[model samples]
Target: MAFGLVRIALECDKEEENKGVRVLLEELVWRTYCNGKKSGFATRRECEPKE
Candidate 1:
């Protein structure tokens, strides 16, 4: 995720920083929660963001 974010930051235009961060966080949320649950890989609630 870190590497992917870094690549996004570097490859994306400066004007699109907000969009990049939004997309990255959205994807992380899906992977951390939805996908995890679907695969039966529990995402610890304590480690998740309150929001």
Candidate 2:
């Protein structure tokens, strides 16, 4: 992900990767991210849920 995007995502307390998926769903809408992707390095699976 781009540095700017990462910054924005982190500021929103969003998890970078799969976990970010949930945050996007809660904070942003479908258009917030890719058509079917999340934010962060490693695949979406890299970042797991807190609990």
Return the top candidate by lDDT: 2
User: What is the lDDT, from 0 to 100, of the residue 18 in candidate 2?
Assistant: 57
Per-candidate TM-score against the hidden true structure: 0.13, 0.17
Model 2 segments beyond 4 Å from truth? 1-11, 18-20, 23-25, 28-51
lDDT value for model 1: 0.30
Instruction: Write the residue-wise lDDT of candidate 2 on 1-51 in tens digits.
Output: 535332222224456785435634354322223433555432233355874
Q: What is the C-alpha lDDT of each candidate?
A: 0.30, 0.39
Clashing pairs in 1: none
Error of 1 at 27 (Å): 5.2
RMSD of model 1 against the true structure: 12.4
Q: How close is candidate 1 to the true structure, as a TM-score?
A: 0.13
